[model samples]
Target: MNRLALLLAGSAVLAVATITPASASTASAGEVDTVTSCGNSGLQSGLSTRLCAEVTGTTVEFYGTVGLAGPPSPGGPGPAPKELITTLSTEVVGSGAAPTQQIAHVLFTSANLQVRGSAATVPCGSTVRATFGVASFPWAPRPVAHEVVITC
Candidate 1:
């Protein structure tokens, strides 16, 4: 009877292992490529800068934010002024040396906080690459570093 019981226990353990779901092989959050800074050429106001990176076999997304530098003008009295102004935009360019097609373009507005945009189903086989840029409308006197984020 003890031998039968031991066999049953072993069989149950094997059954459980077989039924368990296997771990997925997809890439982790950190595997995606990201670019935080581009040399010393700071992004100018009213000018679009390029955020470029190579991405293969995964989707890529972009995010940005603008922070105010200082308080509003002192002369103003009627309305309290807000300092920081933020905006973000994104576009995907193919990787080939002479590629002529754009994968996607996304525009984000203040209404959409955090300015999250994404391009999915990008060419997966080769080393896919893309570039995006950001700029202010009227060029703020004290420009702040715009926070950018990316995910795959």
Candidate 2:
């Protein structure tokens, strides 16, 4: 009886030890690591844009903000704060696959508006390859996108 019990207990322990790692690996197969990137507006002065992105297993986070990059001009931010519209987007690339993308629009009212963000975090089924964060500032002549790249 003692031998049988000992053998059964040892087998159970061995089975558990082996099973645990497999389950852990299976769970982590869909896990995503932290990926971060940042971008800056191409503006010279006055109101400027700063954008960043963080990609995780379940969500892609955007940190887009508008503030004073340099000394303000004699005039205020713009003809209209409503016109101070900004666009932030992300191309999250993982495991050599096509990038999952999301975009958000933000309006900068004043320097007090610290952070503007987007709610797009489509789960990546594999490890992250890279995260590309793009910010578009509404300039006079034409709008251009500035990109920040982050690889994991």
Give the candidate number with the greatest lDDT: 2
Model 1 per-residue lDDT tens digits across residues 34-152:
44442122343432233333233355444443222334447865222222343333333433345222232333322222334454445444333333334334455222222222333
39, model 2: CA deviation in Å?
A: 2.8
Clashing pairs in 1: 49-133, 51-132, 68-84
Q: Name the weakest run of 10 consecutive residues (lDDT summed) in model 2.
A: 126-135
* Residue-level error in angstroms, candidate 1, position 83: 9.9
lDDT per model, in order?
0.39, 0.49
What's the distance in Å from true for residue 20, model 2?
A: 32
Q: Supply every candidate's count of residue pairs whose N, Cα or C atoms clash at under 3 angstroms.
A: 3, 1
Clashing pairs in 2: 60-121
Model 1 regions lying over 4 Å from their true place = 1-57, 69-113, 125-137, 140-152
| lDDT per residue (tens digit) for residues 76-133 in model 2 | 5543444343444345444354544444444544553534455454543532332223
| 12 Cα displacement, candidate 2 (Å) | 44
